[model samples]
Target: MKNNATLCFPAFLIGTLATLFGGEIVSAAIYSITNTTLTVRYDDATQTFSVTETATGQTFLIGGKLEGEAVKATVTGRTIIVTQADGSTASLELRENVPFVFVHKTLRNAGTTTTYIQRVVPLTFTLDLRQPAAEPRTMGTAGLTAPDRRPQHRPDHQQANQAVCSSAG
Candidate 1:
């Protein structure tokens, strides 16, 4: 009879070694922990990201995503709200009808031993925001009351004029 077990032993050992050393060697490797990791979706226009812990009752909002995490944003009215998108299942604390606000996050785990199996790092993120429209003010384009920076848009009416002329001619 052929001894297949001996032949497969080397393959099994390699797999075991890889599993233990792969992540240790690769510092930036992204790992998944079934129900671990904090994800947030941001509304850039509003400057907010909805934050939540997928496995726990923790939830919040942040101005941006962490360094390695992906973030997206949207703006509405005077307020912007963010949402955490990396998580498969998480609830956003911002109500569409409510005023704009931010929520901070802190990590806390109970007596569950499984909480230590962290494939993703959990960070205590605090959401601090700035308000530009805090007071009612007049807006102007050509005066001393200009903004710190200028907008970049051409005043050329070439496109509009061309369309009108073509249609008329």
Candidate 2:
């Protein structure tokens, strides 16, 4: 038989909320955190983000832009660690669930006849105070497309500047 013991009021309490997202995210955020760490749970898989604090008792939740470019992100327990100088770190699992989004849009110029496209991709999620995170792969597969045949223009110049266009017909 399972021990049904809560005879007295417990001191440690954990709070949580159901996460919802719109705009550009279409995935669930399943991440966790502890006093010294933050964790992510996904389809039976697990990852942990790490954090170190000199103080205790007071819970905390921090958010920052995650830069996982040209690399695979791996989270083991509840705190994420960096290896060297360029490494950036953030903490989770203390105050409230957090949500973040990073959008990536891609445009393909096939055939080369039509030349103009613009794109915008958005990813969003709620960070659970404990074991809260969405799989990077779960990021919305969304985007906007705009193409410019003026490939000869500077990378920045390639961007359309309607403000500078003349209206002559």
What TM-scores do the predictions have? Answer: 0.18, 0.19
RMSD of 1: 24.6
Cα displacement (Å) at residue 137, model 1: 43
lDDT of 2 at 39: 27
* Error in Å for residue 18 of model 2: 9.7
lDDT of each: 0.29, 0.26
After superposition on all CA atoms, what RMSD does each candidate show versus the true structure?
A: 24.6, 21.8
Worst 10 residues of 2 by lDDT: 4-13
Model 2 regions lying over 4 Å from their true place = 1-26, 35-61, 68-75, 79-169
How many steric overlaps are in each model, in order? 14, 39
